[model samples]
Target: MFTSRAKIAQRLLRRLHGTNATPLAKRPARPSVTMGRALALGLGGAAGLLGSAMAVASLESDDAVFTNWSATHSCHPAKVYHPESLKELIDIVATHHAQQKKLRVMGSGVSPNGLGFSDDSILTMSAFDRILHVDAAKSQVTVESGVVVGDLLSHLRTHGLTLQNVASIREQSIAGVTQAGCHGTGAAIPPMEEQIVSMEILTPSQGLLTLDDPSDHRFQLAKCGLGGLGVVTKLTLQCVPMHKLLETTTLYTLSELKKVHASLLVENQHLRYMWLPYTDKIVVVTCKPYTDGSPIGSRISDDIEFRLEELRALYKQVATVPDPDHVNWRFTQLRDSLYALDPLNARYIARVNETEVSFWEKSQGSRVALSDDVIGFDCGGQQLVSEVAFPSANGSDLTFMEDLLARIERDQIPAHTPIEQRWTASSRAAMSPASSPLQEQVFSWVGIIYYLHEASPSLDAIKDAFVDYSKLFEDVMAPYGAAEHWAKLEFAPRSALERHVLKDRLRSRFPLEAYRTLRNEWDPHHILSNDFVDELCSTDL
Candidate 1:
């Protein structure tokens, strides 16, 4: 287990190396200058390269290293500045301000968006990752920016506390999660950032500023601020006591799935489901709070590696052989197990298996086959993705889903993958791609994936077709107000984003004008400006 500080430093190194043209050590450093004195010499943007080697040895703790989820990104920091304390963070920000380089705060490198990296400087709050204060009476905990969600949860468990909700993966940095406005399903709930009661912001002009009482309009707006406002050094999150989850999983026919949806929701504390498009069936997952003398269940011991290998075999068989549908059946049996069992029992199951049957067991992670090593395999490298969320304002309904599946089968689109469908309640965060005003709106998330028989095939010809299909689907879901996920491929043109979200409304909540004022007020030199944020805000999409 790596210390939080060490982990953060490693991630910085990875980020730096990932983008740099030359490998880190071989790259020449700027002319001689001290770390702090280097700033005085007017070397801001290029200083990160020099800072990388220095950061590796300066980690504050081992707990810090365990905080990072990906080893690939651990050694990429242009400069890893780990302040021994929060006070140091203020000085670092102020120093960068003087040097004319915008400073970016890194949480965990979970986002594909290049927001966390910059040519200037990067600051990691690994040293400050601790539970500063926990108020059990008020059900709140003040956490440093560098803390990982899983670590926090472990500590909270000891204190009989837990976050009201968490994302599928708990490896995210506390500061990073809030900065990106990560969220989960449910209408009664808000995004993770919404739980923040206050934040300690380390800004250029105002050092160690605290935004108290996030319920206030200013605080709420800044809670989801895309790190353009300032580096969040710490956060105060509202939490609830730990509780056992009683869950249930059931397969429903298309009509039954639609009919029982309401009862399932009203009867459970948490609900999510998956659908195999064109199959007329949906996997229903429902979880409720269990307060009885329920025993904690044991962790699963599934042969995940073997299963992944089998999946690769299935994909290969489907691609080269004629038993494509058989492969699909096998995969569904494995994937559906995530929601296949009754919540009240201690039962577990593999909800989905590449094989055609669903059985009891624990939640199984998504895995696809690797055809690279298979003998006689000729397809070039294939990319697999899971892109699902509420349909856009233009998506179709059950009929559309069924029709698409039938069409794929009829036309033999060459892309043979089962479309997984899941339903989610509305989201309150304005920036959420799936934002909706009606809390009870049920939106379906459909994923379309393709595996090829050749390497690096051109997707241009299929792009137009995908757009047409997405538009039709979006039109069907318009009344329900659906949206897409950020990281996945999108069919909605940049123009639709403008008209759909009412960019003016986003500007209002994000406080674009005020943020600009704050940016100018805090970072007068435009040190932190990046083409990514600029393009995102400026683009019609």
Candidate 2:
């Protein structure tokens, strides 16, 4: 029952790698623009000085200058190559391998930690975005690495199929999500990397190899291998039958959350908690699959029209203060700060958080929507986020949450609202934070956020406060068997000892030496090695 969009897109992603491989003539390739004429997207930093340090403009000598979605990371590579065909990609890899050059493969550049940044030869997966095959009987679909998650979901909708789980955002590349081990909130669902039925990786030394069998050690390691062993060109993913979802957003007190936390996971198919800091408020979101229904309630609040006015008021207040040039009236975080009398004061921020609790109380309701539409939520503007995963206990990780909140309040930190906690079943990917040989174990992910609203005079000070807040949580969570999410692991500045300690901690949890040995076999010359992966391979520990 595959329609043209589903049949074609699914086939478009896989057919390019078949026995008689040929480029699809239906969809035209995305043409690259020359330097100085290409898009100059530069975001300096969540920190004031860091933002100004990035040179957003492209140089005449360079093919293109790149910055990540959050602007936390940027790079000016010597050359940027776009290979439209698999044969062309193989040739490029072979040449880079022969020269023993540092060639890094990139996706949508959405990683906040700047995983895609490279100073040497940079290759984009932009042109490889096609759905190559679909086997409805097996509930599987094949796609090229560059295919955006949003587009893939739209295609699958037509075929009455959808992914088992997806991250909160849809703008990222499929390969990036899988490699970074992104996840959705579900006690039974594993991280997104578990969707990979097989991946066709273009390795420097091995030419092309498919990691298909789950029992194979290579498949487990390379599934979330941090893109070291090879460049993943295409993958076959397991999909489920399409279904609608009923979502409800409800307000709760911190005590109430502790009481009902275990029951929430047992009752709902997907659940996430937003802990409003400095206030005794928590917002619990639950989504359950539904057979058929009309839209029931409004997820949108009645005061939506006044959101901009609240932002303008903050901008006006920020502009009149000392360091007048810092607040950008145009760049806003309406949900982040509705009313901040004093943006950095503990007592004043608590009032703002209380106002936010009121806002959620008003906005709380139930609604029915398609799974794809409901799963995607607005992540808001550029922000600095750090998330850690720990084994789930008694249905939730409230013990860790209560400890962290106590520390934040005791220190009077100017933390933001809605510090979140989400759950996922463990993954088979060897390096994943929730790594396990079995998928039955559940893990809880807790996150702290500091919104990077543009032009705030208090930006640097707020960032400093976050450092203390996060450090305390890290120290407390160590005994609970915690590990930072792969994508957000190295975002903070670390000293040599800190770096060595982090490396050692990672080695203790993951199969670092074994992975390193396998990587040496697949990419002996280290042509595909990037900074992140190189750090893991280092023996300095």
Best by TM-score: 2
Which window of 10 residues has the lowest lDDT sum in candidate 2? 45-54
TM per prediction: 0.63, 0.86
Q: Distance (Å) between predicted and true CA of 472, model 1?
A: 7.5
Q: Give the local distance difference test score of model 1.
A: 0.48
- RMSD, every candidate, angstroms: 11.2, 7.7
Error of 1 at 33 (Å): 22
Over 32-85, each residue of candidate 1 has an lDDT whose tens digit, in order, gives 111321211101112222223442322222212211222111223344564545
Pick the lDDT winner: 2
For candidate 2, write residues 1-541 as lDDT tens digits. Answer: 1122323233323412112322233432332223332322322110000111112212232435566666567777776666667887888889889989988877666777777667887776655667888788998999988777877888888789999899986756788889888898888888999999999998998889998998898999899977788999999999999888899999888777777787887788889988988888888889998766565666645455343444445435544453343233222355443323344677767766765665577668877888888877777666777899988976449888888888889988767766889999999888888898666788999988777656455767766766777787788788888998887877347788888888888888889998899889999988777888888789985
What lDDT score belongs to each candidate, Candidate 1 first?
Answer: 0.48, 0.72
